[model samples]
Target: MATTLAEFEAKVLLDQTLSTNHKSIIIPIELQEKEDSLPTNRFNKLFKLLIIYCLVLLVYPVYLGYAIYWHNINSINISWCEGLGFLLVVSTLVYTCLCYSFVLSPLVDHISFDIRFPGSMEKVIQSNEVRCAVSSIIILGCIIFLIIDTQDDRYRLVSAGGILLIILFGFAFSANRKKIVWRHVIWGIFLQIIFGILIMRWDSGRDFINCIGSKVDTFLGFTDSGSSFVFGYLVDQKPFLPTKLENGSLAKLVAEEINNSTAVKNIVVFKALSTVYFFSFLTSMLNYWGILQWFVQKIGWLLQTTIGTTACESLSASANIFLGQATTPFIIKPYLGQLTLSEIHAVMTGGFATIAGTVLAAYISLGVSSAHLLSASMMSAPAALAFAKLFYPEKETSRTKSDKISIKPPSEVNVLDAATQGASSAGLLVVNITAIVIAFIAFMSFINSLFEFFGDQVGIHNLTFDSILGKLFIPLSLSMGVEWNDCEKIAKLIGVKVVLNEFIAYRELGLLIQNEELSPRSAVIATYALCGFANPASIGIQLATLNSLAPQRQADFARVVFRAFISGNAACFLTACIAGTLYNEFTYVQL
Candidate 1:
């Protein structure tokens, strides 16, 4: 007989009463049979949902492929593929929402599955063994495929294999092998590969990403205009026309020379740093209008759905694309107290892996490609969660599992007030960035001077920090498919970024690009490698910022901050590896 809700509740009460009663009572065989069927029914329902979700995921990709084929056959632009992807994404989201609201919500309270099995150490050891064997087979297969496919210059393919091995070994050596989740690591690598292929290889993907990059450049150009209005000729780089003196006096020449010197000295301040304020203000106004929140939620939902991460980690990860690491924590402030250690690690790692949108303009000003930078920012979101999970798997259960993201608006006032507040907030950021640049640059110079002095005494007069770092990190750069000749140069940039910050590294990269010192492939790889906040200074910043927001988790933050820094570096390197593997030198054009 089928069980009713009333019968189920009555059975539950009877079981409780039987347990509490000191005297043993004989239970009816029919009731026991009914109870056994209840669990089976719940499991069947859950299994069905899982199967349906899997089918839904599978069908969308198939549909996307078919749509691309149809578009190509009809002589339509392949760009429609992106639209189809978006439509599928929306459909999946709506389906998920409906299922949760009408089906999962009620069933969740009635059914619970304990996925953790009983065997502990034996299971873990066996699991690790299987993981190592599978990973080795995959790596071996890839190397063999590369060797077989390339008729000429096969050594480069072998070198790529070696590089991949070294990166895997480096991360594995640093990670806690017992606690590391190899599945997450493998998935992370796969996702990075997929992202690189889509963004760099496929025509439709390239067009979509390029369109976004162009829009970003256009928006930044608008910000530049505002900066020019406020700072005059200082913010905008324009040719100066000298005034013709009526009498051709020496005083006129002196005045012109003074003006020229001032302009030259102020160029860095005006051209690079000043535009940040305007962009920040615009971003703040968008946040106030709910536009930024909507975008963040959609992106966060995607991450959560795919990566199986908590809402807080997912939201903060997505926010890092548009906001600074320091600013992203505020988006999920209410849920900070309830986040597990692993979730917090993901948050911090994501912050370090990607950069804020306000600074993209500054990097673009330094000659980095807008499309590459934007791609790195978007790809790092999933990569961050992947590495974070590998390094520190979630041990404690999360208190909240709702997919909905809660972002507190930055302002409740009018647009003018919002703009004013945004500008003010941006002013502080400008001062902070300026101070960091000056202090770090001066400090590195001092250290380099010491290195030079010691090296000169030892007959190595050309020795400097960059050269030292280059030598130390050449293997790492080479592993990213950088040419042997340019490995030192790329390595030096990576070292500088890790030791100092991405700003300094990007500045040096800009100089290298201007001098044509790096090949196009190498330049693209370096851009991805350096697109992060994974440096010594960021640890302190994260600690201070997150501690202020979630003071109770100070101990937790301190414990994972250093690991997060390492994970951040790994995340950027993963992106770089994918870029090096898929990116064609012929396709890259300086923007």
Candidate 2:
């Protein structure tokens, strides 16, 4: 054993191999003493706790004071409560990080397979089945919310079964409870309150963050101006797709409106609308031209400096492998591999809860009302945080030294290289979008056909997959304040989002609005719900992305992807729920 140990230590020192599988060479600690040898900093933990407690002490009182002064409760009161929830979220996150790092990880380090069981508690926690079970709960929550709220019943049984499976799996295989510490939980909440207090107390700091967010958004909008222009132009020129939007009630309405309009003879007005389309084409061409790549990077950097980069798209990361998932988080690459699991989850969830720049034009073209686009984008940011935490409470092994954001600028020998790279990425994006649409549409069509046949034989008229999905999710939609009858319709809309993509879902939403199948509130909720790309495909994308970045941590990356996906999807839904509930509550109060 001594000879083997010496040989392994020597091999690791020589650095001959870097594969994670060669753990014997890479990790020098003897199996028995690994726990004792692991690093621990009581001050860091205590200091973090102190910071959290201080911030919380500072913020909640102001909110309470405001609530009292108003004498009438309003969204501000709800905002305070939500703010508390946010603090709880942060506190839990901090606690999760501390415990995972200080407690669970040491357990993992010391455990050796020499024993009969041959595994650490962390190993138990890391199981795919365990992760999947946890994930299923989060996903089922989303699905349940969708079914109950959207008014669809087609997949009610399936969703219910999924929920049952999640519960059973969770009970049967719980994550290692040995890692948890009561202090961590209390400290997490305390820290959240402290941060909340800081946010509340320093109006200037709070404003600064909001201001930074607003400015970044404003700049993004400006940069996307060309793309938006192109989208509008296409709408004016194409008016309608030949394949989509058949000659039906909606078509007749558009035709009648156009025929009755007198603007056709006015060449000036006609040309103006035509010009908007021209710009839309130009912007769409630019998106494909790689202009957005240049601008998003430039602007992403400016935003990072102001808001702390890892919070969004940091500018200090690598930009290699620009074609695949690697490119998505390249803006925050410097922080990757080093981030605490919570932070990594934050980045992943943000990506999941928000659409990629490649498809922003498509969403715009899909008939999202312009005002709603901004609203959707803004809503997605916070929603990402809410959902990410719920699904994957950060384990202890995940921690980072700082909050610095990082990104890697495009490395090009010349302007042409930059343009070429951008165009290639754009081309690939176009192909990906086109392929996804065709495949998903076909898949849905096949599903509908099979269901239609079965339904017809059974004397059911609306027995499509969507209908079942809608039924299952209707109750959740209602909880979000969607009318009971309208819940199924919205549920189908969300089902489409999960199974296929948000673009199709939004397109369906526009039609629903035209058909008056949704109220204004429902439309708003639907928009929020469908703003993100938190679907199953994204899980594969993130796993591949993170795995490539830290090849050594590939197993860890893969293990967590399921949880990340659930967290991402749930984050978007939670955002929608918050938006829906608040919007409805406010609207009722006004009435």
lDDT of all predictions, in order shown? 0.79, 0.53
Q: List pairs with backbone clashes in candidate 1.
A: none
TM-score, per-candidate, Cα-based: 0.72, 0.50
| Best candidate according to lDDT | 1
lDDT of 2 by residue, 1-591 (tens): 999999999999677555654787547555536655444466668888888767655565466556455645543443322444444444566557657757897999898756344467668777767755755665566556555543533332332343333333323332334433222222222222233223323454345344433443443345234443455433233343334446666776675566455223322122212222333333344445454455455544433333332344232211111122335665555556676665566567667766644455455444454444444554455444433443444465543333443334446665555555655555555555556767888989899989999999989976788888888877656655565667889888888888787767877887787787777767766776777766766677777777777777676666666666665566556545544533422212211
Per-residue error (Å), model 1, residue 581: 0.5
Q: What RMSD does each model have against the real structure? A: 16.1, 19.9
Q: Which regions in candidate 1 have their CA more than 4 angstroms from the true location?
A: 1-163, 237-266, 403-405, 409-411, 586-591
Report lDDT (Cα) of residue 326, candidate 2.
33
Task: Give model 1 RMSD, 1 decimal.
Answer: 16.1
